[model samples]
Target: MPRWRSRTRAERRLAAEQQGHRGEALAGLLLQMKFYRLRARRFKTPVGEIDLIAEKRGAIIFVEVKSRGHQGSEAEALGAVNSARIVRAAQYWLARHPAESGKDMRFDVIFLAPGRWPRHLINAFSAS
Candidate 1:
């Protein structure tokens, strides 16, 4: 392949990997929703996007999906998930929904990694 083509493919692969990780996280969340008898959907927002939104017995859930296959600690990456991004995304989410505006809500992060157990960290952070 030409150098340009190879570089394009690499970029596409990275995008695909990121998207795949999100899909895996959503799938895991679906399993959790099922286990808890909740209803869920993938969400898209203007400010910040959420991978999944689940509502169980009472509360609303907003989920962020992160890839967790780093060889070393992910202190840097986790830190990079700053409050501003969360706020932006959350604003996008909240602005789009009228009915859910008044409901109780929470944020969760589901980690996606190969050969590693799935980790669902509930209430990962309060809304910014």
Candidate 2:
């Protein structure tokens, strides 16, 4: 059996969390390379949590990062995102930061998979 198959549930959960952190870090680096300034990581509100918040050219972006171990799981990763929860979190974030209220807001997704370049989807979803 694979080593992962031998691990306990908590161990697997921890591993998954670490993988998610790495994915978010990679996504952050990609954003910075594209000249986006990172405003927050793992921003948590009463409603939900946003993985990353970046700003550029007067646009405030809320990003969700999804990492998968398998090559063909990227689409499944994207499909697993809770868009409504993310939207609610963004609303809470905006309410807390009134300064960002006037700027254009967008939702983006970064999908990461082993052996594949990170796929960035701009305006991937909407608050509407």
Q: Cα lDDT of model 1 overall?
A: 0.63
lDDT of all predictions: 0.63, 0.94
Q: Give the CA lDDT, 0 to 100, for residue 71 in model 1.
A: 37
lDDT of 2 by residue, 2-119 (tens): 5555888999999999999999999999999999999999999988899999999999999999898888765687789999999999999999999889999999999998999999
Question: Could you tell me the C-alpha RMSD of candidate 2 in Å?
Answer: 2.4
The ten-residue window of minimal lDDT in model 1 covers: 36-45
> Residue 96's C-alpha lDDT in candidate 1?
70
What are the runs in model 2 whose C-alpha is more than 4 Å off?
Answer: 1-5
Lowest lDDT 10-mer window, candidate 2? 1-10
Each model's TM-score, in the order given?
A: 0.67, 0.93
Q: Write the per-residue lDDT of candidate 1 for residues 43-113, one digit (tens) a residue.
A: 55555556666776567776666665553344554564565666566666666777777878887766655
Residue 94 error, candidate 2, Å: 0.4
Candidate 1 off by > 4 Å: 1-42, 72-74
* Shift of residue 69 alpha carbon in model 1, Å: 4.2
Error of 2 at 90 (Å): 0.4
